[model samples]
Target: MTTLRDIALIAGVSGATVSNVLRNRGFVGAETSARVREVAQRLGYRPNPMAQALANGRAPTIAMVFSDLANPFYSMFALEAERAARRRDHFLLVCHAAKPDGTLDTAYLGAVAGRLSGGVLILGSDLGRADLLSAVPNGVPTVLAMWEDAADHPSLPCVTLDFREAGRLAADHLLALGHRRIAVLAGARGDRVSHGARLEGATARLREAGVLGGATLEEDSIGGGHRAAMRLLEAEPRPTAILATNDLLGIGAIQAAGERGLAVPRELSVVGITDIWLAAEMRPALTTVDIDTRRIADASVNALLDLIAEPDALARDALRIVGRPSLVRRASTAQAP
Candidate 1:
């Protein structure tokens, strides 16, 4: 294997100079740095990450823990965070912190302590347990993203979205279309579907409009939404619109509508939260609220990196960044039939 010393010898420079040039550390003449890199590339020298970590007294990696990657919403967030982390020349490790049953993995946090990871960014879905924050090591900085309420963790830094605003946007869009009979497809009651803010916001709007509607608690997936929609469609006064908590559920509602021979935006209107990419091209196209996943991911990773660089900042004051959501009107919603 080609070593730093071999490249240094071939380049006629000291190993320390070669190391500095390779690591982009202390200042080196531009010509000399280029020469060292040329020699290193010629010799095919690969820096030992473990040795580098040992020398620098830290790892060049961070971990992001989130729920199922099956959901395009979370997948998009991960992709954006990975891109942001790479820009800082830091490696990103994604962990599936939630089990198939939508419950937090108790062992996920404990396992992270064993890695050489410098910090952790946790998705809000995995923050169900109050004691989760206690599991992270004392020195490693942690950032929570996509949470509806950052106040629950007064001292922890977080980046979240206004789920209430998201809910209100969805409700307002449906109401403006003159749809009074609506049903919300969400997780079981007290299951804290999307931080519970979405349900509250939508329900408040329904009450204001004097609409008699309620939520049908179910799983947070396409199949779950289908099952819930099936039941909701059978009501005495069938719903004219369906407000799903996520894009997956929204897509599922469209599928359910199709199965019932109902034409979307004609017989029934469907609106979803989090405008995932798939929502735009579905058969009927979905009218959903858009949460800027890229912005949230970038903000979350940047905040965590800053925390890692200055752990003392957390002691001085907590950091909380919130992003806004907007409605994306598409083909899935129309006037009440």
Candidate 2:
């Protein structure tokens, strides 16, 4: 049987759009609706009786609560996740469950978990595992995602990448380029996903190579990188390379280098982790570690749906690790001068 996802993959439309177009419920533009219908017909599509019954019966959206949606990385993952959930016949509800001070709004999380679509996937926030576990009532399926530390097994189901490896890859790439006077511009604590684990991996790799790479903590934004890089460039022995924990910071550093009259890869080199799409579009494309965002999102949604199906599996720890961070060396990095 051709699933909605199968049609979606072929049609290049969202699962929700396919559902809406087929059911003739939501308002999809004529051109799009026609295309979806045409694909459905070609595939000899027939709706499952049970699926139709479920559509008439219960909530259809799975909540994807994030620490901060403002981050492009989260938005990128959101797109992938929405597609993943739609493929499974589940709509995605994105909730920013962060308080003003940047902590998980446990009350908000408790209110939404497993209530819709019988599952929820929470991304990284500044909440402790105990607090994170406590938010969702027992028997409600939940999965944590975008977790930086793959080794810190929380007492909940999760889908994460080896972030430490991502950090190490960034450092190794710079080291191989003969950039020794490097600066580690780390993201500040507790906003979006923390980069401490990634930082640790990079610093560890630098130490192993006998280079005591100094670090600076800045907000995990391009502006923050600009500020830190502007200062770092002023030092007596300027850093030839900078390893930002996130792509935003790395881009900022690149801009800062340009403002200082330094040409990227000629006088200054920079690398970042989490290969957001923007990294490639930048003037000097960033050299960063690809964490495989779409894979994590797809795996996370699949894991949440699995939890909904197998309630008993929640008795023990459940972890579904996906994605390996590898270096994507773009124009931003080159051999040290």
Candidate 3:
């Protein structure tokens, strides 16, 4: 196995500097640190003692890096992923890798990925690919889990649901109820269009029916959805139905309707993607597309383990698509008024 000494010898750096670079300590100069890390990556060096344990016939552990843990969707996914990991005789760790501003926190990732954790599973579409490729070492086993766009392959192995199909299901459900005037509450990752696949599918579905819907962008949260819906509700002739990119936005739209004295499914209808646990528990129950979080979680863990066992699979850049998005019809939607 390649060690700090091997990397230090190759890079002509002291063993301490090699250790410092791998651990992300600020002790080494930029030039030396880069040289040391580059050598480690080329040598396939992993500083994690857990990896050493794996070589001795012990079970391994992997980490799930997520942007937000507070979101019920992520929490549910974490639970399912942990269960999946256990089934495979591997341990799972959930890391909150979101910066205060909700973007991907690369610093935390640089520390634990393939080091403190044996491998890593990155959750959500909000994290930038460039940030990811730079943060994770070249030799680390990594998988991008729950990615939004299946068409756009990343630098690592990927597992995702057909999010565009989820959007289509939501739009089709509303259209079936004779709702023509529809509006969208799109969730974004900072200024980037995070939920573009969902939006694209819905908009295309709407266009096929000769129906055009206006869309507004917002943060991917309840508060963002609520604010966006509040404004849409004030439009002249106001939309009779609202399509949210996800359940959190859908739930918020439902709340916004109530505050405006508009009865859901009567005066207004709302539909969301990603039928999380909270979606069913919400009053009037959220009508959303079930992306099957458990299946995706399980697939992600299995894929990461596959990469860990055979690092050569990274060269194939495997993209695993699991589960179809289906509509979960409930009280929040009905025939449009």
TM-score per candidate, chains pooled: 0.84, 0.81, 0.82
Error of 1 at 70 (Å): 2.3
Give the alpha carbon lDDT tens digit for every residue of 1-337 in model 1. 9998899899999999999999888999999999999999988888898678757666777888887777687788889999999898777888887776556575776677426677888887545655555556666688878876544543467677777788888999999999988998865424655537777778888888898667877777788888889888888788999999888888888999999999998999999988889999898999999988888899888888887777765552365555688999999999999
Off by over 4 Å in 2: 1-58, 125-127, 190-193, 314-316
Error of 3 at 76 (Å): 0.6
lDDT of each: 0.80, 0.85, 0.86
Global CA lDDT computed for model 1: 0.80
Best-to-worst ranking by TM-score: 1, 3, 2
- Candidate 2 residue pairs in clash (backbone atoms < 3 Å): none
Q: Name every residue pair that clashes in candidate 1.
A: none
lDDT of 3 at 122: 91
Candidate 2 yields a Cα-based lDDT of: 0.85
Best candidate according to TM-score: 1
TM-score of 1: 0.84
CA lDDT, candidate 1, residue 332 = 96
User: Which candidate would rank higher by TM-score, 1 or 3?
Assistant: 1
